[model samples]
Target: MRGLTAGYGPVRALDGVDVTAERGHITAVLGANGAGKTTLLRTISGLVRPTAGSVHVDGTDLTAAAAEKIARAGVAHVPEGRGVITELTVEENLRLGALLGSARKRTERTAEDVYTMFPALAERRRRDAHTLSGGERQMLVIGRALVSGPDVLLLDEPSLGLAPRIVSQIFGMLRDLVRETELAILLVEQNARSALSIADVGVVLGLGRVVATAPAAELAADDALRHAYLGF
Candidate 1:
């Protein structure tokens, strides 16, 4: 995204946002609540139309395209709420994601692959999604997104409302996922420390604008920046 701008009605949540999530890397978008982190992902996924700038995957321009069109273009967004079909079983949820994925990915990444990635989910494959714990639900949603075989994965607050151990497990899995595949992950999080620990690069936002953009370690090491914008 370059010079991306979007909002809800008159409130501009994202203003002139410039970001690039490269393949094989995790770019963490860190900020306090209402810092426009969610808007960034929504705009890129075409859920919120951008009033300015462009969003492209590989080489195709997808500015203001339909959400479904963007998904087919290989961008999968796992929103903050750990969204899943409560009525479906663990395995069924993954299969649904694969079916909605691009035709090529349906064959490339299957539900079995997701089960392999998250063994906890594999253990509960037959259970309904609503029966899982908070951490398990988070894993299930991410696993479902992975089954889509997206080139770019947008994850919002994956660590929210989870224990430290569970957060570490999920973050470690994300780090390994990018290392093993060409997939790029744009992670949006209020948990700056956890996000920076696994991210290759960091982009900090404040009041709908980028306050800092640098290597994740550098940002993590900056005491003033962390306290000022990151809040941890």
Candidate 2:
């Protein structure tokens, strides 16, 4: 996105922002609360429209597109809080993901692939989503998005309240997914240290704009930036 600007009422959540996510790479967007990290992903996914700037994927402009249109364009968004359907069984929830606009064929094989990616969900295929732990719910949500065959995945604060071990496990899988599937991930997280450990690149946002953009290791190594924005 270039020159992106968005807001709610008179409050500008995003201001003249520019960012990019490459295939097979993980770009971590880190900031404190209310720094516009969530707003960045929301604008990209069309949940919120940008007042200016263009959101282009492979040369197709998606800035003015609707949320559904953007999803069909292979940009899937997993909002904060896991966004799982508590009433639906694991399999039912997975099926809902494929029901959306997707270019690939949704077959039993595809369902099997999702189960393969998340064995815990497979074990609880018949169980309601709310029965699962926080980490399990997170995996289920990510696997559901994968079922849609999206090229770009925008994940918001995925490590919110999970244990460190669970967070590590999930981040490890995300790195592997990027390498194996060549999908681009834009990870928004308050867990700067964890996010930088696995991310290929990092973008630090402050107030409503980018303050730093660099290689993940470089960003982590910068003492001033880390202390000022990363809270580490």
Candidate 3:
């Protein structure tokens, strides 16, 4: 995205934001609460229309595209709050993700890939979604998005409401996935330390604007930056 600007009535959530997610790499967006991190993801996913600028995926201009069109264009967004349907079974939720594309060939390929990556999901396929733990629910939501076969995965707050061990396990799985699938990930996270640890690149946002953009190692090593901006 270039010069992206968005708002909600009088509240300007994003202001002239320029960001990029390189293919086959993890680019993490880090910020405190209400720092426009979620808003940026929503704008890219077409949940919120940008007042200015453009979003391009693999040179395709998606600024004017609808949310579904963007999803079909291989940009899958797992929004904040883990949008899992409590009434659905684990397998049903996975199938719902397959419906995002609806092409028989693509759906079959995505389902096979998702189940392969998330073997635990296959084990609990018959269980009700609500019966799963918080970490399991998160995995289900992520697995659902993966079943869409997106080129870029937009993850919002993956570490929220999970135990430390579970968080590490999920992030470790993500690291392995990036290496194995070569899928780009744009991670929006409040867990700055952990997020930066695993990310290839880091973009820090403050009050609707980017404060810093650097390699993850650089950001982690900068004590002043971590203490002031990341509260670490």
- Against the true structure, whose lDDT is highest? 1
Candidate 3 TM-score over all chains jointly: 0.94
lDDT of 2 at 106: 32
lDDT of 1 at 32: 86
Task: Encode model 1's per-residue lDDT on 111-199: one tens digit a residue.
Answer: 77777878899899999999999999999999888888888999999999999999999999999999989899999999999899999
Among residues 3 or more apart in sequence or in different chains, the pairs in candidate 2 whose N, CA or C atoms overlap within 3 Å are none
- Per-candidate local distance difference test: 0.91, 0.89, 0.87
Clashing pairs in 1: none
Candidate 1 has a TM-score of 0.97
> What is the lDDT for 95 in model 2?
88
Candidates, ranked, lDDT: 1, 2, 3
TM-score against truth, every candidate: 0.97, 0.96, 0.94
- Sliding window of 10 residues with minimal summed lDDT for model 3: 101-110
Candidate ranking under TM-score, highest first, comes to 1, 2, 3
**Of the candidates numbered 2 and 3, which has the greater lDDT value?**
2
Off by over 4 Å in 1: 104-107
Cα lDDT tens digits for candidate 2, 16-93: 998989988999999889899999999999999889888998788999999998998888899999889999998988
User: Candidate 1 vs candidate 3: which has greater lDDT?
Assistant: 1
